[model samples]
Target: MTDRLKLMQGNEAVAEAALAAGARFFAGYPITPSTEIAEIMAARLPAAGGRFIQMEDEIAGISAVIGASLAGQKAFTATSGPGFSLMQENLGFAAMVEAPCVVVNVQRLGPGTGIPTAPGQGDVMQARWGTHGDHPAVAFCPGSVREAYDLTIQAFNAAERLRTPVILLLDEIVAHMREGVHLPPPDELVIIDRPRPAGPPGSIGAAPAYRPGKGEVPAIPDFGTGYRFHVTGLVHDETGLPVNDSRVADGLIRRLHRKIELARREITFTRACRLEDAQVAVIAYGSAARSARQAVREARERGVQAGFLQLQTIWPFPAEEVANLSRRVPQLIVAEMNLGQLEAEVRRAVSGKAEVIPLTSGGGRLFTPEEILGAICTAPGGRLKKVVHQ
Candidate 1:
């Protein structure tokens, strides 16, 4: 590991990592808890010959980023709360068109700009299903400044490798927290480049022409190239033209789902600490995972057989690992900053094999160590009691 460390805010680290990952375009509107990312990108991206645009609104910002990405430049945008809501339409468009780009959502309390500057993990489920339809997108969360850097690069890599929009889900606390992060040496990082077309530039003879072979991710031809293709929200065939036929719709939909689901092995990552012989496991992610880690350590010190499963990838849910752990452990506590979003998934995965408990709080607050321990103490059959807040 590189020993050189400097104190950096999470948003700064994300902007720095995007630049290092070869992202050359950023377009976003200013929003609290995430504006720092845009500010840094505007200043720093120019230094690296990258383009930055501060658009009028979040919708335009994401639309511009998608446009840039289709032009063969890695692109990104950042927002929070209401801004994130504004970007949903374009985000859905990006997913539908298979536009590869990165979107950083520094989440704040919300239903409608609920708390712009306060920390909250309320966007966990939104990150998965905020966009319409059955489109699958990869979403990752970073609990620390170092992970803000690492996962941002991973988000870009995932977008290019899968030819889809990838979301970097960060809460207000993680986005604002300043911590020492050791910058990695340039040569040690692995960066992914998008697939390129195999044949000569204008080899495809017809309009809306392209080939994405069976079980293979297609190379996206950049716009401004001689080869013309259609981009739209409507279901389209492999050639990129809108098709109203059911067969074409079915194939397109299945491919979109399969392409992401089949790549789960590459997308899923989680940390299991002291789970080998534990009887109780705490499932957590994002900044909430930080508190859970501390709680688990303290629980272990008190002779409790507690362990932690810290998720790095939020979407796709790591079901297999969660199921296996659920079976091994007698009780499972799903701690999140939302009201049981992930806990529901944990219950489905375990299938009643273990006692599933939810410890959640919303509106810009986190579950503290003492609160977690209290949950542990009050667990029925040694499992935490489900606490619901309306």
Candidate 2:
């Protein structure tokens, strides 16, 4: 039920979606699988009255995004593994300063540039803990081309709404695959902009810069708008002044984490298929979920009670739902491109409630439905002993 339908690669969908979400500034370096996002933004941003800068490297790229966001522009950047690693310093800064920006990591097989063109979910844990300190984070994982577009927009929205850096974690397969998708009309889609400070820019506002009045998110005063504010990576007070007092630093950390904790219900995303009466469950995300979904179908055909859960939001781990699902089934099978990143988290959540099995690969290709189905069939006897231990 849409007028506009086009066959677009996942990167193309993400670029357009970011623009639609009002991303006016993009700073990124060229990296495989994610370079198309920068290319499209370079050509498209200017036409939409936005700015696009090709930074010297990944570190500079994310640094520019944080600078732009501080100046009151909705900004984003895209990069693959090695580049994503370089951005970790600024990523920590963006979180500390509460800069509302989006970072897209189209993951490739990597510790240090393992395979540029091949897909991998090895960045699952990195996206959550790559940065140095404890800070709030919201990361989205998409499974399909259309989902890439939707989740990209969600990344921007979450950044603005939460007043923190958000991540769109994609695999190379989703970034390169092309599919025709019918999108909803503009009016039907919901958009959220960054909150503006109620107090005058130059005046001593009643509330401090980082203090939230009603919602957990603080109102932002644009940099050029005469707002007297200080931004720093060090722990800061509500007034934006760096503090050495452990009490003040403790409060700031608590607030930073509490905001995300309170919003967990609004952030956790998962899709369950035929899990109502499943004897075994398949847990996966990104491209891995595609195979898991198909395996569920094939297993059902073979008279197996199997189901699949596609995780859309990777961080703030969907613990409650995962725990419930573990209680529902006798076993849970985790599938991913990496050896086992998400599997460890799921295993921790399940906590012996079910026999956890891992169907993983580090060879840059996606796991087959056959592999997932085999796990489901042999789940009872626990024949697959390759569980990822913490």
Candidate with best TM-score: 2
Backbone clashes in model 1, listed as residue pairs = 379-383
Q: lDDT by residue for model 2 over 194-276, one digit each (tens)? A: 88787686555535678865457788687777777788889888878898999988888888788778878888889999898
Report lDDT (Cα) of residue 307, candidate 2.
86
Worst 10 residues of 1 by lDDT: 205-214
What's the number of clashes in each of the models? 1, 0
List ranges where model 1 is wrong by over 4 Å: 204-210, 380-390
- Model 1 per-residue lDDT tens digits across residues 1-390: 657679999999999999989999999998999989999988888889999999988899999999999899999999987888888888888888778999999989887878888888888888888988877868999999999999999999989988889999999889999998788877999999877665655675332333454344667678777666777788878677777899988777778878888789888989889897777878898898898889888887876778889989988788898999987888888998878888888888898888998898975777788888766656653443356889
Root-mean-square deviation of candidate 2: 4.7
TM-score of each: 0.94, 0.95
Q: Tell me model 1's lDDT, rounded to 2 decimals.
A: 0.85
